[model samples]
Every structure is written in structure tokens, then in C-alpha cells.
Target: MATVAGVAVEGGHWIGGERVSSPTTFDDVSPIDEKVIAEISRGGEREARAAVEAAGKAFPSWSRTSREERARLLHAIADGVEKRLDQLAIVETTDNGALLRSHLRGVMPRVAHNFRFFADWLLTLGHEDFETRGHRNHVSWDPAGVCALITPWNAPLMLATWKIAPALAAGNTVVLKPAEWTPLTASLLADITAQAGLPDGVFNVVQGYGAEAGAALVADPGVRRVSFTGSVPTARHISTAAAANLTPLSLELGGKSPLLVFADSDLDLAVDLAVEQYDNAGQVCLSAVRLLVEESVAEEFTARFVAKASALNQGDPRDLATDIGPQIHRRQFERIDGFVQRARAEGATALIGGGPNTDLGGLYYRPTLFTGVAAGSEIVNEEVFGPVLTLQTFRTEEQAVEMANSTRFGLAATLATGSEERAARVSERLVAGTVWVNCFFVRDLKAPFGGSRQSGVGREGGDWSFDFYCDLKNTVTAPWEK
Candidate 1:
């Protein structure tokens, strides 16, 4: 078996279906122990430009390929992903510090499923037709030209494929810039795409820092569309660059989402989900950072949430028993600590777990829960992006709804109530892209997913994604004279 740290990874950019070496290389250190895991080839703006040129050259043929051919290729890629699922998952775990168990059960399966879903969807999609008095109107969806896909480190391959699969399925050539924090899995994905016989330049990866490589990809004139998943600051930068050429963009940015628990809700289930908000060490964008409980049950729910959160096992990501792993890097761990300490300074009470776990070293922070958080405190409004949760109480249904929608982010929300009517009403009232009635992080690929306000700009899954990646052309023609 090829272990993540044991394997010698070639970290070069994949361009024109070939491994392109760079003049420089950077060490990819594992967040688990800060050990140099692999030496990755580092490319800069020059490399980014070359990648876009390659993708531009390949677009015409790939776009003209038959739908059946495209679907066949996508399925083959999915099969390739499945063949080495375990190894790939291990790579992701080591690179990002997600537990191996989570990769096996959740992340890895979703990566393969994304490809399959897009491929299957292509088969069912049909062109639109309309008839008029003197003419027949038909709508044809054509692939957008070159596309730039920039994915974050927390869930690299999965998020990248959320754009890649749909872009490729729509016949658009893509150049992906995986976050510098975790580039191993993205490189591995490039290898799998090659094995599956994906044509040269259809899918390319440029691995380097976001400032140089990522900006270059987004700013390239030849790239027509950009799909990015990362911080709001970065998205704003990309938006500025993309605007130069009026490039279309799909931005899935940050979130400080809320999870509301009504008095009539299932306390046990809500408590369990409250703990899970810290999943991925709380680096998730849709993490329920603000826990809103009905005033009547606030105390009880806070106690239960704190106890369950403190009980989560944190250790080496390789251990299947480890429920929480280290942060993506040391800097992020420190940033999270600053957030916690500032919250305390701002008068928030740390109910349980507020500091780093020195026992495990690396970048591990114990799951922290806070109560008595001010309405507009830093911890309540800002995205900690760590294993931290803040609690607030609401007296009425209107207050719950208002507090839940208070943040500038509108990415996702969770509401736990026994009554279906209450669930429907509250879910509708909350301003988020996806709202869970009684569950957290339950996703349906067929549904549209993205946020409003500062959280994101466009949808990413299913038909919404297909529409984003293609240009809809309407053609009207008169019947034959005969």
C-alpha cells in the first residue's frame, strides 16, 4: 500500500496532458505534524498563462465532441477515481488533516459521485423547443470557452470537481488552482484524469500560491468563465480581475451560518448536530458557528452542546477513532485562537474547551463552546473557521429568524423543530442558499446550492451548474417554403 507520507509525489503542473516541471519547488508540509510531506513544483504567473493558452487551444475539439462521447469519458474518470479511492482519500487526509474515516465515508465517495452525477445528468438534458405562427424557435446550449476553477484547501478535490465535472460535462476546458495548503489530492486528480484518457489541455492544474498562480488564472484574457470556492477577500480579488474582461463567475465564498433549536425540537438530535458543526475542525463554510436556541431551552441545550463537543476525540488524522484532527496549518490555528481570546475579551463565556491541545501538538485546537455571546460580538458575526461554537438565545420566532439571518453571510442555515409547519415557515424565512429543517449538512446534488449577500454569487450543483458553464443560444427559423 502507498501511504500518504511514504509515497514520493510528483507535484508538477499538468499541462497539455503532460507533467510540466518548474524552475522552483516548495515543500508541502503536513498539518498533522508540520513535517515536510512532499516537495511540490511551484509555478507562477507565467505558468498560469501557458495553462490558459493550452486550454484555449483544446476547447474547440472538446466542445464539439458528441454528448455520448463526453458522458463515456466522464464515467471512465469516475471509475478511475474509484479504483484508487482509498489511496486518494489518504492523500487528502494527510494534506488537509481531515480524519481518514471521514474521507472513506464521506469526502471520497462524494468526489466520485460528483463525476457520475454530472455524466448521468447530461443524458437526461434536452434542448428546448417552441413553435410560433411563422417560425420554430429552438434553444441550444453551447459550452463556454476556457474556464478557471479555483478551489479551497479544506475540501480540495470535492469542491474542485463540483465545478470541474459540470464544466467538462458542458464541454468547457478548465484550469484548476487548488489551494496551496492542500495540493496533493488535486495533483492526484490530474493523474487520474490522465489515466481515464481525458484529452490534453481539457483539464489542467497549476499548483502554487493564490496571489500569483490563482490571480493569473483568473485574469487571463482567454478564460471566459471563473468558478471559485474560497474566502470572501480572495473572491473579491478574483471579481476585480475577472471584471477586466467581463468574465462570468460563480463564487461560493464564506459563511457564519446559524443553527436554530426550538423548544419543541429533538434536543438529542440537535445536540448531536451542534457538535458536528465542528467537523473538518470547523473549517467548513457552512459550519453553524452561531447556535440560536429558544430562550426557554437555551440553558439545557447549551449544556448538552458543550458536553458533546468537549467529548469529541482529537488526535492524528490517520486514526479512524479520531473525531477531530488538526487545523489546515499553524497560522490558521493561531488565527482561530485569536478569535477565541477576543471573544473572551468581548465578554463571551467559554462554556467548554477554548485552547489548543498541546498533547497532540501539530495544529490541533480543542472544540470550544461559548455562551453569553453579545448580539454583534466578533465571535458571533465573524467566521472563526475553527472548532469553535457561539451560543445566543431568542425569545420569539421572529427573533430567531432575525438573528439567524443577521450575519452578512447567507450561505446556509439549520433549523431543528418537531413541527413540519414550523420547519417550512422558518426555513423559508431564513436567508440562506440551503436550509436544513432538522439536519445539518444534508445535501442533494440535484438542488441548487449557493448563497446570497457576501456568502456567494451563483449556484453550483445540478442544472444550475450546467447553465453557468454553458451559453444558451436561441435560434428562430421559418418553415420551408414548400
Candidate 2:
């Protein structure tokens, strides 16, 4: 075990309300300084099977528990998360290399909010009943046994809870297999839920590689539902494994989302939003890394964007003044650099940063912007998932929409314009799950949040979450008089 930011890291898996170790372990490295923070258990099929069994065993009693009781337990989980907010934030920042301020102010708080919101929403959830052909039909939502939640390392804890809270609220037991790169916070969350008076075996975690443990979890017949957030290739693999049992899946995969800036839009506001692409070091799936500006204002927008990006302080994530931190791992760092190199080789011009930030060292890539990017080029159409933005100019609203929808991904898009008509019309035509008018990353927990096309398979938020976590049952009754 190793200590991160004074918090003693638990290196074993949390299974059946107890800590479980494996015969082998792997190093958990921090991207910030390239340090080995902990030795995590290397679980394979054995641990995955045990976790699924535990969840399956608990499903009977847990699913039968009253909704009010489930709601109370969910609130208690939120209380536990809030109590350990500072500790969790520090550990997460140390593990993932995200700015400490972001975890403190936004990410960690949202983790607690996820539980609280789902808990309250569960109490008010309802189904419809109607009469037709002199008969009554009743619709009910029932928990769908064990849920396999495979979350990414980008925003580990927050994203895990986004799936966990709703699954539990819907009375389904969960087995969360967090990304191998950032596994600390998920272990802590398991502890938090256990402390919150959740029943034994209701929630379990198995720490290991995706190929072994993750594959085993998804392939198990007991796992009735699977929710994954990561690369498209990984989602395809998980989908294949889950297809064995015809288990339903909710996949929130990669994105090359676009930010469309109109000439009439406020230059400063548009610039600010464009700079946000570097947030979380541009690891955010919903980040509009592709900037499609109207040709009339393309030059001005590029100048302002380049200036803002240049001024961003890339340094130690622990420092409050640091605007961005390191990529999540060395491999990710290389991947980003490769994208930049290929883009340059493909004739795109680097307006500002084009490579690693050597001054600060250690996995830090400078905030980069590329102009003259061809419409169908790999750099323009593919997801870099880094602190890199590609600029393209469009002459008309139709062209902007075409450029935005050109990518195979349709996760999210941002439209910046002054005219209300343009906002409505452009947003409607843009092929994405979420379209923000003159804004970016503003999320409402109750709203439908998931991608479209290759971006994702299903939606999950509010009732949409319940729709996936629970099985819908429709019962019809004949009229008594008949």
C-alpha cells in the first residue's frame, strides 16, 4: 500500500463488504510526476465471477426492499461522500493528474450530488396506467439483477456514481470495474457505500485489467445490464461479450465534438468556451475540440483562442495557479503527441503549441491549436482526446452544421450565435446528443445525457436511467363485468 496526499491508499478490491486481494498485483502510477502511487490487485476471471455472484445473491433481498429504504440508503451514501470530500478530491487529483482545484470545486461535489439527486428522484419516480378496450394496463419498473458498470479513468469517481447511484436506486446490485489507470477512488467509494449501511454483497468492486476482469464481468450471464464509458473499440469489445447473453448495454464512447462559432456571436464568450477544450487537459469526451468558425470571424477567433491557450499555465496539478495538468498516463501522452505529429504532417498549421510542454516536464502536453485542417482529415474527424483543438472555417450555417456532423461521433456540440433563430435551427440540424447554445458543459442531472450514432448506444439520466437499470413490465386486466 502507498499513501497519496496523506491518504492511505487501499490497494485491494472491495468485494462482498470485505477487502479482497489477488495472487498478483500491478503498479498504479500517477501521471502528474510519473510515480507509482500504489500496488493494485490484479483480478482476473476468479474475482470477477465472485463479485458477480455476490451481487446476484444480494439481488433478491436488495431488490425486494422498499423504495423508501433504498432512497434512505442512497442519501446516507451521499452523506458519507460529502464527509470525505476533501480526502477523495486529493486522492483523485494525485491519481489522475487533474487540477486539484477542479476536483475540490466541481468534480467531487458532483459525485455527492449524483447520489443525492438519484435518491430523491427515486422517491418520486412513477409509471403510467391506462384503460383501453374496456381493460386496464399497468406498467411497472423492476430491478434487473446485477449491473456491470465499467467507468473510464478521466473522471473516475464521478462517472462511476453516475451509473452506480441510479442502479442502486432502481434496486439493482452493482459490480463496478473501474479503469486500471485510476482505481483508488473507486475503492474508496466502495468503502463509503459500505459505511453508509448498504447491505453486504449489494455493491462490489474488482480491480484489474479490462481484458481479463472486465471481459469476465461482462461475459457473465448473471450481469443483466452493462454500462461502459470509454473508447469506441473497447465499447465494441464489451458489446460483443455482452451479446452472448443478449444483455442490454449502455455505451458512452468516444467523441470528436465540435464548437460552431458564428460571426455574430460574442467574440469573448466564444473564445472563453473554446479555451475550455483544455479543461481536464482536454480529456473530456464532450469537449468541443473541433472549432468551426464562420469565415468572417475565423481569423479573430483564432487569434484570441491562441492567445488564451498560450497563457494557460501547465504545471503541477497540486498548484492552484496551474491551469492544466499531465495526461492520465505516458501512453496517453504519446497518443496525443502522435495526433499532433500526424496533423502537422498532413499539412495542418500549428498556430500555437505543437508538442509536449518540456519546461514543466512529466506528461504535460502544451495546449495546442491547428489551423488549415482539412474537413475529412483524420485529425479533424477523429477524437484526439487531448489538450488539442483544430480550427476550420465555414461560410454558412449549413456548412457549419455539415462540418460539425461530418465526424462519425455525435456525442455533443456547442453553437455560439447571437440570433435566436440560428441557435434553434442550427442546433436542430447538428447531429449530436446534446447541443449547447452559446454555452458548454452545462449539465442538468434530470436531462437525457448520452451520445448518438457511434458516440453511444443509450441515454441515462432521471427516468432514462431507470429505463436501463430496470425491466419494464406491462400487465393487462380484463373488465370485471365481462
Highest lDDT model number: 2
Q: Estimate each model's TM-score.
A: 0.98, 0.99
In TM-score terms, candidate 1 sits at 0.98
Q: Show where candidate 2 strays beyond 4 Å.
A: none
List model 2 lDDT by residue over 91-191, tens digit each: 99999999999999999999999999999999988876899997899988899999999999999999999999999999999999999999999999988
Off by over 4 Å in 1: 1-3
Clashing residue pairs in candidate 2, if any? none
TM-score of 2: 0.99
Q: Please, what are the lDDT tens digits per residue for candidate 1 over residues 1-482?
A: 12365554568899989889789888888898888787777888989999999999999999999998999999999999899888888888889999899899888889999999999998877676888997889987799999999999998888888889999999999999889989998888888999998999999999899998999989999999999998899899999999999999999989999999999999999998788898999999999888899999988887787677767888998999999999998889899999999988888888888888878766999888888788888888888899898888999999999999888999999988999999988988899999988888889789999999999998977788888999988899999888
